[model samples]
Target: MKYAPELKRSATIALWLILLTFPIMVIQVNTIENIVVWRWMNIAGVGTVAFVLSFLWQIYQHRKTESPLPVSAHLPAFQRLLADPKLYRPMLIFIAAFALVFPFTASHYQINIMSTALIYIMLGLGLNIEVGLAGLLDLGYVAFYAVGAYSYALLNYHFGLGFWTLLPAGALLAAFFGILVGFPVLRLRGDYLAIVTLAFAEILRLVLENWNALSFGPSGISNIPRPGLFGIELTLEQSAVYMYFLLIALCLLTIFVIYRLQHSRIGRAWVALREDELACQAMGIDKTRAKLTAFALGATWAGMAGVLFAAKTTFINPASFTFMESAMILAIVVLGGMGSIVGVIIAALAIILLPEYLRVLGDYRMLLFGAALIGMMVFRPRGLITPSSRTYVFQPSEHQERT
Candidate 1:
């Protein structure tokens, strides 16, 4: 009796969902054959799923309202597993071993996919610095990515620079562009900042598209050589293996550097700025320097990743650095959990690899993917893994205690 209202609401939700999806889910027309197929079972399925989901949602809301503990107390099972060093240390070791052996075991196609995922992990971590730590919204991060790719492509085409020479060159050039972006939007925040960054990316793309002589226009630069192994020529398969290992090393280096930065003074300043600009300014932290550094550091990773991307694909064009690329990278950071290294890595892999694996489902793959994203947002709005607060334990020296 007490649950009557809840049940009634769930029933109403179920019916509404069924009504909304009737045309799409319950009926399919064959254009070639002019035949209409009725899938009445889809109606029943929708109703059942909607009702159960709505009921569960109500129960969850009820418990949430009644609970006194903080949201962090209700950590997900995966997070709990990670929190236990006894379990996670072994898990990390096992993962590292598997990663080292994966290239040898997997097919070249699979290796390529994994390499792409690794690139996104780098991008996600870089953006984590800007959006997650510094609370800056950059919608045109791909601009720096494009800058790095073009830097390598153009310099190589004109001056015949090698990948080894261009790797650092691209990163430095991207960092320079990051500072350029930071300067213009020094005072902007929120949506305004997003708009400016997005505009910057679009402008760059447009220039590359129109500048036929400089960028080769829409035809794009091709036949770009792969990363050379100390002037030792290798077969295509061997090069793929070499590239995979290189990316792995770079990913490790990125993780180590960013982890250290996260605990440094500038990192703290970024976090403070993220929390409150006025308070951050009042605390004597240089807001301009913090913002610029965040942008510069974030773009550095993107630039490196861009060089890797160009070397791996052996092609370059403006179409490749669209707004969608930025959005997907941003999704990796946000969905993984802002300011969390492990979360970004996991989310990048899942976001990039999940769709490829889901191809078996054909047309329904994206539908299921969208549903999963919706469920994730509804349940874990904070992200798959929220950044844990830092805790410091205090200890007193024996002499101080005696005094």
Candidate 2:
């Protein structure tokens, strides 16, 4: 029978990690002497960490599988608290309070990083609509983000329009492009659709990069102005704080709108489409409308995020919205648990903060990160926050008896 599968999985992971990280961890560049050096000790340390984590994961999995009850059942108090909405409501409130007060306690560096994470959170929420809700694989969702950034940058530079005014303009323009891009791919599905969308993004990026006359080319458009609060220009720290709050508002708006849409009739239709296109068509749902709407709405949010990103950095460049960026956004969605808001937020924070915290590792940071991600996928394929919702059951007998 199958037993200790985790051990087999961990062994595979350890082997891969050694192969991937050996060269980086074992070899070092001694810039002072201009010579290449080998650090066997460092390699051993890195390998040990990877192997230990994998082995521990196996133990955790064994315990989890052996337990017949839910994972949270061991913590009776926590389970009871979660079961009671009244108790959890206060906890949620406390969490929100802490978030509101977080910047005050943290450094400017931390605040800035958090703001970046929030932007990705918005992007992840948008992409979730297509990949998670509608099951549309889009590898070039960053096109809309670039569109939004350029739209805002060009409009502001040419017309002297402020960021507040440019926000909706960017989203609308992105949504327009979304529809334009969505039309051609409506007939395509799966990998074909993904390829087409990806091509579309590359085309847009190339246009922006080469058309220096309009986009300022590879040099990028700089000196982009930041939004002010109450017509007052703030210091760098104040600006960072203001941007942080702005992101908070935008993130909440995204969450609320997506939450509403997820529970609405349109959401139900999208879910049907995702489950089985043939079955969805047989149920009388209009595939065209559902698909287009998903694209439009998802792109709209990405555009908004792009606008925020431009404003935050005060620069717009094609390099900022590359295929790597798209991959990162997709990774956040997948790692966060598709169709889960809280999961997306948590994943975004982890993706952003983990790298920052790993700065001490220097060149070895990404190696460890990739290994951790692999481990996460192996151990918790469903993601840290799995997609879950409450269900209501109706009893016809009870209704008749009551009547």
lDDT of all the models against the reference? 0.93, 0.89
Instruction: Report the lDDT tens digits of candidate 1 across residue range 1-403.
Output: 9788889999999999999999999999999999999999999999999999999999889888888667667787779889899999999999999999999999998999999999999999999999999999999999999999999988999999999999999999999999999998999989999999999999999999999988999889998889998889898888888999999999999999999999999999999999999999999999999999999999999999999999999999999999989988888888988899999999999988998899999998888888877777788788889788698888999989999
Give all candidate RMSDs, comma-separated. 3.4, 4.3
Error of 1 at 344 (Å): 0.9
Clashes in candidate 1: how many? 0
**Alpha-carbon deviation at 256 in model 1, angstroms:** 0.6
Deviation (Å) of 212 in candidate 1: 2.4
- Following a full C-alpha superposition, what root-mean-square deviation does model 1 have from the true structure? 3.4
